[model samples]
Target: MKLLFIALAFIGVAVRFAVFVSPIHEFASQRVEFSVPTNSWRRVSEGLFLYGIGVDPYLGDTFHETPFCLGLLSKLHRVNPLIIDILFPVADILAAILLYLFAQNFLEQKVVEEHKVKTSFKKESQILMLSFDCIRTVPKLVVLCYLCNPLTVGSCWAKTTTVFTNLLMAAMLLSASQGACRFYRYISLVFLALCTYQTFYYGLLFPALHLYFENFAGSKTHCRSRGDSVFGLLMDGLVFIGSFAIMLVVSSHIMGSWTFLRGVYGFLISAPDLTPNIGLYWYFFTEMFEQFRSFFIWVFLINICIYSIPVSVKLRHHPMFALFTLLPLITAFKPYPSYGDIGLYLSLFAVWRHLIPQMRQTLIVSVMLVLAATVFPVLWKLWLEVGSANANFIYAITLVLATSQVFFVTDVMLAHEKREWHLKHGVETVDKTGKRLELHLQ
Candidate 1:
């Protein structure tokens, strides 16, 4: 496993480095929202220039990335290639490694814990163990899945900021899985805030992560009865708010005012940029009228933010699944959806690979994923480059793309519930009447 991971890591680094230096980098960086101009290595260099000139990168509306990221890249503006080439691949490698460790931790925990409950009428007792052999192969699989993933490589090579978000997310997951570890808990909260700063919707993951911590104490009441639970939740909340506020303050100071907040974060929430991507938001708002813009913006924001509640509650017992469930929905609803964001979830999907057989609608989901991946570029070309097709053409592909993701997420959620069911019901869940039990979603 070590040897396999080492090889994958090297190959991943080499692929990203090769892509960075290759001619194809320009094309992919410019054309794909997966590597948008504002967040691409090239534009990052442009933003870096202002930092060198003692001007704030966040001073203008041209840059959309986090201030700290811009400052980090600015420090590398000169002779940065030497380190820059390694930075992205290193981030990818780190994310994979972190996931491997997280899987190990999760699986180990599963092996140690089981709840046995006897049926009222039957002589049989059911055992619930949340962990599958889920760990033994998981670490290696995540390393392979993420490092060898084409989209992951593409996003890394394109120097898209989403790669960093993926890294932070991986770290956050690892930290959250570490039960009773105060250091990791604080670190997770900080990273969570950083992710929200970078990508607004990531704030939704807060509830899931918090729920994980709450239950990591063994039970809800156990966690609640402990004084640390109250203090810990309070401290975590403070850390989250403080970290974000500090970042905002530092960025605001650099920019000479609070204007950057509106220029950057506001642009994100308001849907002003009509750049085409896989999201459902851009075109819908693009076609919207000036008079009704404010109304629709609030409606869209509310619609997007509302899901975090139901999802967090439904899968609270399965916090990791709850976290995973939010990805596809965000992909479909976010203001600036891109393939990079999709790639993050897709690579992470390896963790759920064990549930493949139980996944209903797998065929339809696979076909949709394939269609979206292939047809999107064609439609994008026809709509933008060739001008032979209208916006509707690409929008149609995006709809398919988002629908495919939605189906994929739903199927996984269904599979997870089934697995949990099996953990309680034995291999066969039949009644005395010889009827099979079925699962249904509300």
Candidate 2:
């Protein structure tokens, strides 16, 4: 499974490199190139080098005050932008693998802990250990979802937000799984910081979701209960203060002073005026609203349906899944489309833990349709803009199909796990009562 996963990831990387090395359209290249200094690491890399040489590469011949990651990366070596693009997908795959390992270990721990609580030295204990094996099922599914993801493949060739978002998300998951007290947590912060400049607005969502996850996971309660309020307080302070710092740094780097905050906020709240005669929020709300409505609605409904299953709902309070669903929803609501909900990809993987039988197929088809709906627009636009099918498109479709397929395969696996869990617990009889049908473990 690991080899197969790695092979698929390399295929994605190959497609990215192919596109980067090829002679593509100028406009297409412009769209795909990492040129924008604000969010483009490549550009930031160049600026860093220029700065090291005592040359100002600012927009208007002034010193820039953005985060230092790009400058640092740039100073290391002179690399092609295409190479940099390839690195994004590669990083995503590597991060995804790390996430898989962490999740697998975490789930094992959960199984043991839950088994201990639910089963004592009784006949049920035997069944509980058998059921514990089922928890091991989720990690493979999660990794495969990332490996075969269409959006991930598509992101490989372009300077899109998806790759960075996924990488940061993977970092978050890895950190969470390792326990928040580790040095990796701070390292995760550095990844979060890098993500901010990689895609600016979209990358910001990762850290935002991280905070939400920390809160949802009972970490906030644990901290507060222990009277260690400083960490949580400091974290919240950072969200507000860091956001302002981002805006201030960007303004200082580009526009000078904080005047750009208005435009930034305005753009976030409303759409940019494409035409001179066009009005404000009208274009944002009405037009783009219609465009994304079906996709957004489908995502919401499908998730709700998937969550309706008993086992699925059981995970509702799990910090990872909770943050996964909420982050995407919040980011999706912004007037500007954000890949921040790339976190949703994680939720999609997490939900595979549920063992609902009847709704399984429906959930699979629904998720595929939603993914297609979300990704097709870009696929079609790129197809039309360029002639003929390309490697990236192929990668994108394969990823979409693979991710969707995981939904099916995982549902079956989860159902099996549920049955095993029941068997171990000695829940032999199923009773339909006036209130509800309950399945007990011993």
Top candidate when judged by lDDT against the true structure? 1
lDDT, candidates in the order shown = 0.76, 0.47
State in Å the error of residue 435, model 2: 6.6
Candidates in order, TM-scores: namely: 0.90, 0.57
Enumerate residue pairs that collide in model 1: none
Deviation of model 2 at 388, angstroms: 21
Q: What tens digits encode model 2's per-residue C-alpha lDDT throughout 1-442?
A: 6687568656644654555566532333244212121233344455666656755455332222243433434534455544555566567667667767766766775566556555443364344342555556667667666555544544444444345556765775566566545355455555555445333443433434354345533543453443343565466446534754664586456433443343333333333322211012222234455678557545533542342233323443343444343333333333333222332354354534444442346666567747754554466456656655543563454346435544544444445445554645454534455353443321
Which stretches of model 2 miss by more than 4 angstroms?
1-3, 20-83, 120-137, 180-256, 259-266, 273-317, 338-351, 355-442
Model 1, which residues run further than 4 Å from truth? 1-9, 79-81, 114-134, 219-223, 226-232, 430-434
Error of 2 at 272 (Å): 1.8
